[model samples]
Target: MFDEGVIKFSCEWQKTEPLAFSGLETLMGWRDRIFAAGLIGLYPNGIGYGNISLKLTDSSFIISGTQTGHLLHTEPQHYTLVDRWDIDRNSLHCTGPIKASSESLTHAAVYTLDSTIQAIVHGHSAALWQQYLNVLPTTRASVPYGTPAMAYEMGRLFQEEGLAQKRCLVMAGHEDGLLAFGETLEQAATTLLALKQL
Candidate 1:
């Protein structure tokens, strides 16, 4: 359930049709790859983190569902798929076993910033995030993830600073939070992967 300053989306999409994306298979493949690399799973104490997404339309995308936890490394059936997440008003608008990624709004803002961005890969790595500050554009140190403020920051990065060209940023306030985006799943995934090689 995502909160908009106007209204929450928890109950608005109660009864929804299944929305599918042509890139579902590829997105899942990338999710698994990131999971295998320990980029989209849990921490040492067991708190889960990270998510992945693929654009479906100008306003919609497919994302890994919420509370995914370690299930990300398990079977494909255990991996929940979220479709038709609307960023304009903040809602899933689709019926699924799991909820949309808590960071759906952030992803939506990226698509809104550039229709050319077809994929987004988000992960947590304190070491990598810290190292990439000089290599990437980053958000302010007070913005929280999954909120409208973060979305607006993303827009500011693109509109004012032209972050769309780089398509990556570190959520300074959201611990270890790092995000990469591109014209395809591989491009976004590779951005995060590039940090590993660094």
Candidate 2:
């Protein structure tokens, strides 16, 4: 299996200063909550296990930096802007103090589904994944995470599985991986939280 937290796409990163916290306030707040719940954290193997993103524009977004999940709290530098991406090319461009999360392309896939979708929260929960696999809009177990194939699965779900209304899905190929998204950060965060009760 592909290791968690590994970037599968060709990333073109321009290291720069951290972003201002003005637009990231809400995103960071929910991040802290999910981290506290153990949905986002470092595995015993030292690899991180989750990421979140906020759409900045039609083609850009602010995503949690790779490997930052171990931190109890993250600063502005822990996030990076995905300036551009090409799903078919399996490439991404980003800028900030740190590189974008490995899951950036998957988030990019979701954002492209609707301009109204503003936030995406990707977390790890074995219970949730096990309980919801195939029940929720789930990507194929043969399709790995953080790659163009996985990204395309999002499109399949939207077109055929009613993912637009469900707003959350399971990644069967990526152990414990779940994605929740909505027009606002709160909605996305709340949707993720509600999954625990299912």
**True-vs-predicted CA distance for residue 189, candidate 1, Å:** 0.6
Off by over 4 Å in 2: none
Model 2: weakest 10-residue lDDT segment is 20-29
Q: Model 1, range 1-198, lDDT digits (tens) per residue?
A: 022111234323333344454766777788888887777877666567788887777766767766564664533333334445555455555444455667877887888787789989888777887887645778887777776778888987787656887777887867778899999899999988787886
Q: State the lDDT of candidate 2 residue by residue for 63-105, as single tens digits.
A: 9999999989888989999989999999999999998999999
How does each model score on TM-score?
A: 0.82, 0.97
- Measured by TM-score, the strongest candidate is 2
Give candidates' CA RMSD values in order. Answer: 4.3, 1.0
Kindly report which residue pairs in candidate 1 clash with one another. none
Clashes of 2: 0
